[model samples]
Every structure is written in C-alpha cells, then in structure tokens.
Target: MPVKLAQSSFRDRTQEFQSVAERLRKSFSSGPGQNGPSSNTSRAEEQRSVVAHQSEFNRRASKIGFGIHQTSQKLSNGQENFSF
Candidate 1:
C-alpha cells in the first residue's frame, strides 16, 4: 500500500517521518470520497448507472405512450373510423 510505503519511506528520520506521516494520514482520512482504493469512477459502475437511467427513461416513455393512446381513443369515440 502507498500509505505503508509513505510511512516506511521516512524511517531514517523519525521526526520528519512523524510530521509527514501526520500529513499523509490527514490526507488519506480527510474525505470519504477520495479515500477509497480507486477514487475515480469505475467503468462498470458508470455503465450500470447509464443502463439504470435508460431503463427509467423507457419506463416513463411507455407510460406516456399509453396515456396518449388512451386519450386518442377517447377523442375518436363515436367518430367514423377512417382508413388512412
């Protein structure tokens, strides 16, 4: 791990290592978002999010389409059916 290396790298000078270690510790622990193994967005997760969004969009669009079909049917009620 980089943290171990950072801590061990300063083994020769205890005082300097202590101060750098404190800084490194703060840097590592400062934020929940950036403290993970890989701070960047994972490709698989991004793909999953995109798929989720598209699925939601399709669901909403289908609902709207059904509503439109129902409205058109009601509007055409009792009217002569014309083949177009």
Candidate 2:
C-alpha cells in the first residue's frame, strides 16, 4: 500500500531528522577534554566519554526511529492533521 504524506510534513520530518543526526555526529566526533592531545589519564577519560557518547547516541537514535515509525503508522491510519 502506498502511504501519502503532505509535502511540507515530509520536508519538516526530514529536516528534523537531519538536524538531530548532525548534532549527534558532532557530539560523537568530539570526546572529553578536546582542547588538545590527551595524557594517560585523559586518554582513559576520553575512552569512557566515547563509550558514553556512543551509548547516548544509540539510545537517541533508537528513540527517534521508534517515534518516526509510530508517526508513520498514525499517518497511514488516515490521520491527516498530525504534527510532531
């Protein structure tokens, strides 16, 4: 079955997704104490920070994916005036 969505709504969702994805990319690219090269202690901290950031990114991505899925389902169910 083909699902129909308003052009503006599709664009809005795409932009929102891109914005979040960019933010996540930026955050994940930078680790703790990103001012300069890391010392031994800072290296450990950086590793931990990387792990934490990865976990957070995964959680947020999962949430966003699920939300998108739900919204898509709702839209497919003939809900036209929906906004997220």
Candidate 3:
C-alpha cells in the first residue's frame, strides 16, 4: 500500500498572506489626496514592491511543500535510505 501523509499548512498560510498583501497593495495604490505626482508614484511603486516580495515568498513556500510531499512519498515507498 502507498503511504499517506497529511498535507502541510504552509501553503494555506502563504495564500492567506498573499491575499492580505494584495489588499494592502490595492489600498495603498488607491489612496486619495496625495501631495504630488512623485509622491503618488513612489507609493504605488512601494505597493508593487511589497506585492512582488509576497509573491516570491509564496513561490518559495510552494517549492518547500512540494519537497516535503516528495520526501513523504519516498519514505512511504521504502525508497529513502536515511533514518530520521
């Protein structure tokens, strides 16, 4: 029989975080009454930067989850040689 393992919560948590980050970015970019064009542009850029970093974080989290799943599969299949 194939080994079964519970999925990790890291991806779920990361997705939640990404949602929050997106909201924040939208709020920041849409704020009203900025003093000048430069200020408004800078704030928009900052929001983009934040969202970009969050996306990178989510990608890394997904990769980690994939690795964990692979390891679990190997252990279940009795293919892993090392003991934990």
Candidate 4:
C-alpha cells in the first residue's frame, strides 16, 4: 500500500482504539475497587494494545519509502550493492 494510505489507515485505527480505551478507562475509574475489569473493558484494552503495535508498524512503513529511495540512489551512484 502507499505510505500515505497506510498512514491514514493506521491513524484511523489508532483513533478507534483510543476511543475504546478511553471508554474503558472511564468505566474502570468509575467503578468500585477489587473487581476485575469487565469483559468489554478487557476487550477494549486488548484492542487498544493492538493500536500501539499498529502505530509502530505504521512508523516503520513510513520509513520504508525513504529508505528505498536512498538505497536506489546509492546503487545508481555505485555507492551500494544491488546484488545479493
């Protein structure tokens, strides 16, 4: 996928994840102590965690295009190897 497209999708996912996380946090904070998280809260936390992972993936993907461009330039200049 294009970097911009991937970034946009990642941002959307992150927003959704953050929304859910916020809801869960609010619920937990409003509840009494000593009880475990509710099922929805647990699921929300899981989903939000995945968003963190996806954000990292998006960051790596963002660098890929720049890396490829630099590598191509190096190869054309005989400054880097193109063969395995």
* Candidate 1 residue lDDT tens string, 10-80: 24688898999999989877764665656545645888899999999999999999999998888797365
User: Using TM-score as the measure, what is the rank order of every candidate, best first?
Assistant: 3, 1, 2, 4
Structural RMSD, model 3? 23.3
lDDT of 4 by residue, 1-84 (tens): 656544443234888889999989987786544355576677778999999999999999989988999988887888444455
Task: Please give the CA lDDT of all the candidate structures.
Answer: 0.79, 0.82, 0.85, 0.78
Question: Model 2 residue 78 lDDT?
Answer: 63
Compared with the true structure, what per-residue lDDT tens digits does model 2 show for residues 15-66? 8889999999986788666636545477788899999999999999999999
Give residue 82's lDDT in candidate 4 (0 to 100). 48
Better of 1 and 3 by lDDT: 3
Off by over 4 Å in 3: 1-31, 79-84
Model 1 poorest ten-residue lDDT run: 1-10
Clashing residue pairs in candidate 4 are none
Itemize residue pairs with steric clashes in candidate 2.
Answer: none
- Candidate 3's TM-score reads 0.53
Candidate 3, pairs of clashing residues: none
Name the best candidate (by lDDT).
Answer: 3
**lDDT of each residue in 1-84, candidate 3, tens digit only:** 998998876544888889999988876787555457887788789999999999999999999999999999988889566578
